[model samples]
Target: MILNGCAIVFDDEKYFSLSGDNVQCDQRYYITNPLTTQFHVKYKKKKEFSPKLLVLMTMSSKDVFDIYVHKGEQ
Candidate 1:
């Protein structure tokens, strides 16, 4: 997770459907911010089950992330 530094807050998309038939495809949630460690990745999609969707993050990284993004208005 970002070269073991970890910091991605949230980049989201999660839709829900399906009433029955036990569902569990992807789920992982962990966030401890003292030293740093963050990961909340999800992956699940169904087409025939009335179209369900969950792809919370798809990151292409260059590594090193402690959380810093305030370059101020360009």
Candidate 2:
């Protein structure tokens, strides 16, 4: 099953290029964690997990309909 936190960024005309603020152009989403007291029992002792960004522009059809999740210059 897919997690709730999965997100994507469309490489639309406005967001095709990685310019200006990268965060502002990319779309962000988070997975929903089931609420349960048992789930957070080891919150303080457990490791934190960060969300991943997946790009779907290349996988999509059409030149003008591509969406990208670009990682700015290192």
Candidate 3:
């Protein structure tokens, strides 16, 4: 999955991808502004669920990004 100019990979294979100005993910509607470096996820009203997973990415000096997954609240 890619978010805010960052690419992420997960073992589960359930991931979101950027489609134009929108972020496509299961059970959520996330919109992204390309001009900004921050993005967030908004859940659907009927299918609302808490975000139990937090993904963090840091950009390295070599221009590569590293992804880290943390369970529970940050």
Candidate 4:
């Protein structure tokens, strides 16, 4: 998903990458909590934000993504 000017690509069940104004030109992030649809983004070790929250607030109500709930460890 692309948010603001950044591109967030979920590589798998555990990895994702961010690239844009705040993010480094080359960097990848690993999901610390994959069970919940929550994650964090840090820029230059200073600025930080939650992409999930941004999506929930900025995205229109018509826009929605499939949500999956995991009961146990994968």
lDDT of each: 0.41, 0.40, 0.44, 0.38
Residue 63 shift from truth in candidate 4, angstroms:
3.4
Write the residue-wise lDDT of candidate 4 on 1-74 in tens digits: 33666644442232222324345754666666656644345334533532221111123334535544333221
Query: What TM-score goes with each of the models?
Result: 0.19, 0.18, 0.25, 0.16
Off by over 4 Å in 1: 1-17, 23-48, 63-74
Candidate 1 lDDT score at position 40:
25
Q: What ranges in model 4 sit over 4 Å off?
A: 1-62
- Residue 37 lDDT in model 1? 47
Each candidate: RMSD to true structure? 20.9, 18.0, 17.7, 19.2
What is candidate 1's lDDT per residue for 1-74, written digit by digit as tens?
44586544444455544443345553344445634542222334434545343434433345433432222121
Candidate 2 wrongly placed segments (more than 4 Å): 1-48, 59-64, 68-74
Candidate 2 local distance difference test against the native: 0.40
Ranked candidates (lDDT, high to low): 3, 1, 2, 4
Q: What is the lDDT of candidate 3?
A: 0.44
**Residues 1-74 of candidate 2: C-alpha lDDT, one tens digit per residue:** 36455544334222233332236543443446536335434243422332334455433232345455654342
Q: Which stretch of 10 consecutive residues in model 3 shows the poorest summed lDDT? A: 12-21
- Give the per-residue Cα lDDT of candidate 4 at 26: 46
| Alpha-carbon shift of residue 42 in model 3 (angstroms) | 23
- Clash totals for all candidate models: 0, 7, 0, 0
Give the clash total for candidate 2: 7
Once model 3 is optimally superposed onto the true structure by TM-score, how far is the C-alpha of residue 3 displaced, in angstroms?
Answer: 27
